[model samples]
Target chain A: MNNMKTIFLCLAILIFLVGGVSNAGTYLDSAHGNSTYGVDRTSTTQYATGHCAHCHEQHASIGGDEPSPDSPAGPDDYLLFSDNHTSQTVNFCFGCHRGTVGGYQTGGLVNRSYSYRAGGWTSDTLDNILQAFTYGPPASTTSSSHKLDDIKTFITGKWGYTANSNPCIACHNPHAVQGDPANSASSAKSSGTRGYPVSLPSDHADKYVWDVYGDDAGEKMSNYVYQAPYRSGSTSIYEPDGSTTTTDGTNLTDYVTLCTDCHHYSPTPVSTRLGNTNLRDIDWAASVHGGKASWSKTDADERKLPYKAEEKNYVLACTDCHEPHGSPNYCYLIRKEVNGATTAVAADTNTDWDTLCTRCHTYTHESNSCINCHYHGALHESNPNQPLF
Target chain B: MKKSLIYIVSIIFFIVLCSQVNAEVAGNCANCHTMHNSQSGSDMATYGGTSGNNPCLTRGDCIGCHAYDTSGTDNVVNIDGSLVPQVWHNGTKDLAAGNFKYIASNDNDRKGHNVAAIDPEDTAAMFGTNGAPGAENALGITAANFSCAGKYGCHGDRAVTDEIISVKGAHHADDGTIDGMSTGTSYRFLKGVLGLENTNTPWQNISPTDHNEYKGINGPDTTSSTTTPANATISGLCGECHGYYHGTNTTETGGTTSPWIRHPTDFSLPSIGEYASYTTYSIVAPVARTDVSAVSDTVNPGGTTDDIVMCLSCHGAHATNFYKLMRWEYDSTTLATALEGCNVCHTSKN
Candidate 1:
């Protein structure tokens, strides 16, 4: 990233434009002019991270794309100064954290598009790079109704904004948003309790007593096994209530919603929807690996989920199976059949069944690795072949 | 004396007629020409006696004279400005199966011709189109190493007709030109025709400098020139069939905001680039082509983009039909789908 530092540097230059080249009205340092774009969801347009003046000048635009000439500049629609026209547009995000002079720890998220120049990047593979940004209901592609009304609406939803809020200012102070001082890893985030510093809420009301980042976790956290819950081989933790104790706060191991404040819990049951099918709710409750906390406590075979090893076992969020951002692999593939053929693209085979299966179960050293051993279905006899392309 | 002479003459006459019919492609006047003007029940013809397949010639002639080209040599020498390809049978011509060019054979692959499909019911025969509607329904779409994507099992109806073609010779019209005036006007025009941005309207000739060569090589000219008709037709042929691909500029609808678009920018299809999609929208940027970068001083000064693509770019349309219209990169039907296509333009250097 020769330009990794350029990301942070762009923001510093914006400080002078906010008001003056002084440290008074700017976001981090007042150089350009004063800006109030870092305010919360409830704050006024001038002082919140969710404000308009955050990323745009309303008059002196920044990026290549410009608004129509006849369009008035008063209350800029969507608060965006201009459209992000370049193919390397992720730089707009990197211009802050991955910029010069101040980021490393938080500058890790790679804009997969800018870096990986191919056809499409699988959402799962690319997620490895965008770890810091929290997402809304993913692409909602799974027969579920989690559809994002539109892109910005989709973006705002995931970044902790209502459907009708301003998105530009949510992460930038236009005056100070230049890829300079504002781009520092530390500067990217406004002082907040959230993992990301782009936008934080006032009163932080979304920080309710529910799961994610707040209260409902007190009961589940009691059984917290530091590293890998089941890895250390220590089985001492238990609740006052027995195994069947239900949400009465009994014997629940994986009940803890550490990051639930930003992400909501699923209302679905944990038994029926295991095959990574149409899981409506956000929580991974009914998934094949959902009840594992308790299941692993009993059956060893319950650990079939790849990326599920306790030495690997950790908080299995919606991200484990799917990426929140868009993916090149059709269906945002955790895995898929090559060319829609029988063979898998990356894993042992191309089938989502194979990839998802091998994610947990061991395979051939035979082909349909799962079918090789366990007699699952007709897949047993199908002479599995890879695609030519 | 009268009876005897009559008998002898009639027998000789019958003998001569039989000999002539046998010498030809074994068909009755209908072998080379279509009669009754019917696109109906007769796949080849109503009373057609035939071999399993045929090339550019009739099936009867194919099996009659040239069943298998044992000569192991290429005797085809196209005379300049000729309407047909010159097939030299002077022992110099190679006794080989012709690619799906002048000779439309039963060989399974061709760049523009992707119609054969896997018969879900059989899997033995490459399910063809000369069957019933139900059979057509069963023949799913499949990419027979025709495209570089290897993923487009792209089977759409021809010109808005739902009649799926599981067997085809040329999907694009002859020679990429649209009727005439347009170069890449085969389908929707390479850069969008009926849609909003139709830039390829005024198609350019191979060399804008001269109009003579352009007109002469307008059709499938086997003639050797500074730029052959085959070469000129390659891009048009590709763009014609691959209408939506060449130069595309996409705008995501009502999303937070769709990317901007003024002039159509190049967005490589998965077929051209090392296609990969991490997320729904996470596409890897398109890489530049190695071949174009080599001789590209004018079009792409520093060689940033891959200008040459499609069939003719790699395979000389005249010299090949083997390995599916491939000019180079031949192994067999199997290998052609793999590394062959990709390696053609990707020079070993970078």
Candidate 2:
């Protein structure tokens, strides 16, 4: 009877082990999975549907057929079927993301001509997004933009990303994209989904959403809660109702917080960062646009903003005046006009007081009438002893 | 006979009073004239080594009558043992208005005005260390020239050259008070000139209180919106030539800012802060009179009207031994001495 009990216990343990593997594979098969890459005959094959021949070969494959031109072999390192050079990481994403493939819409192209990437794009949209990546020829001396060939260099050197990675996979999960659907409201575009903590590498727990609702009972309480893609030093999961829970997993909808993940962690000082890196979290704190004093002076309903009733409070977000992706104007300003002026002002042009200041001031004064009340215009000229009229 | 004697006594007394009032050109007429225009057949009209039929029935021209004799004595007409003051002289004593001999002696160009026949035409560069700054003269005059009692000279006609036309009807007038009116009321025969003046003669040993009183205003316009005042002051009189440096007008000052774009003149010294500490009047940077009626010949002249900043605070009417006709050596003075010179007014800078 004791030998019979031992056989039954071993058989039950094997069944439990198989059940755990199936559950893990099901989680990875969610809609956020990378359907284009990393497919092979393995225990996790049941979760993926893409063919493995697209990226790998079991034995020696044809020479010079690698996806990237810089790859050392036909089947590059780790049988990536592409070049493993750091510069070719973006090119790999470009394959499926650029226009339709196999008569099916693969993904959006970066150029403005395509409809997939056309939600709210302008002529300079791609150039603005490319500003964060460092993979192009060296810019001329006159160019004011930042440039680096390796996206991983910025991740490791400035953003403290220790794991080897590419830009898209670094911020997005190829398997399970886990976050509340409501969190998509904060993206630069509504089409993009929120990021999930599981997408990050195992060693990158410190980069996950935590204390997002400030409900952490320990010393890990966060000063401010942020939306997904943006990370703080919190371990708590985000919730939909603006509250946090230890048992359930959800994400907040404050998309500007996601941008802070890379921006706020720069190794260089905010004052010295190239291309105005301090605009979002740092400069916004001290700027007049960020302060509530000017906004509080007027009724909230009387404000001239273009937000919904629920989002029309005096407290402004960075997106109120700036477009995250790109804009025709330099610095990605939302509107090309300033003050009350009719003309669209360039970044280098002088401020037009009528168009810009009267937006909130609401008074109809002449453009050159600053000296009527202030001591700024021409000098006094009449005789002092003359009778005043 | 008794009434005739009384009339003669009255006439003599009136002449003596006239002599005392017009002391600058007093005494008998013979001292400046020759009746026959000949003395021992050497024509008296040819005196002073000049050739001309002497006009005004006088022995010499304007220069000769105003200059000193070879004996180094001033050409003065004495009467009743009273030595009347001469307008021009080369004696050791210098008058309140400096003598023209300095310019006549071929000395430095700055010694005196380059009056015709006394000195050559001014050939010096404009805006020199000793000349007026180009910004200070709104008339755009690039060089300095001289004429007798006319446009370029010191009498009423500021736009004419004839000596008789400029000094017309000014010599005989005996009024000594400068009531900001007629030539008789003008101080030092500056006909039609507007300003306050010290009526007291023998203009020497002048103290801060005993000096010439200048007309000014109560205070500057706080808004900095006005320029010239309706009434003229001593600074306005100087502005007749140096127009740019006087008023707060942008046109005059060539600036776009005001109650002043340049240093302010005829404005009151504020009675607050460091200015209140000035209990005593400074001879170096003397204040002027905003209300001429309030003036008194006393030390430490006190009143709100007595605290005005005037052009005379930094300049002298006649020539001085310093550059730009400044009353003091501005370059040599240090800022630490706040109690003297510019620091007296610019107290905080010290």
lDDT of candidate 2 over B1-350, digit per residue (tens)? 99999999999999897666763455465665568776787666543455455645565654555452534555353533435444445565544444555555445445444556456535544323323332233332324344445555555555555544555555556555566465556655565545544545354325655555666665433211012222556666565554445554453331322223245566666555445655556666767666665345432223557777766776655544443334554323221221135556644322
Q: Tell me the spans in candidate 2 whose CA falls farther than 4 Å from its real position.
A: A1-389, B1-24, B34-107, B110-121, B124-145, B194-201, B218-232, B251-259, B293-304, B333-340, B348-350
Candidate 1 lDDT over A280-340, as tens digits, reads 3443232223322422332234444223344322333322233233333334333221111
User: What are the per-model DockQ values?
Assistant: 0.00, 0.00
Docking class of 2: incorrect
Best by TM-score: 2
- TM-scores of chain B, in order: 0.29, 0.70
- Fnat scores for every prediction: 0.00, 0.00
TM-score of chain A by itself in each prediction: 0.36, 0.44
- Predicted structure 2, TM vs. truth: 0.40
Candidate 1 deviation (Cα RMSD): 28.3
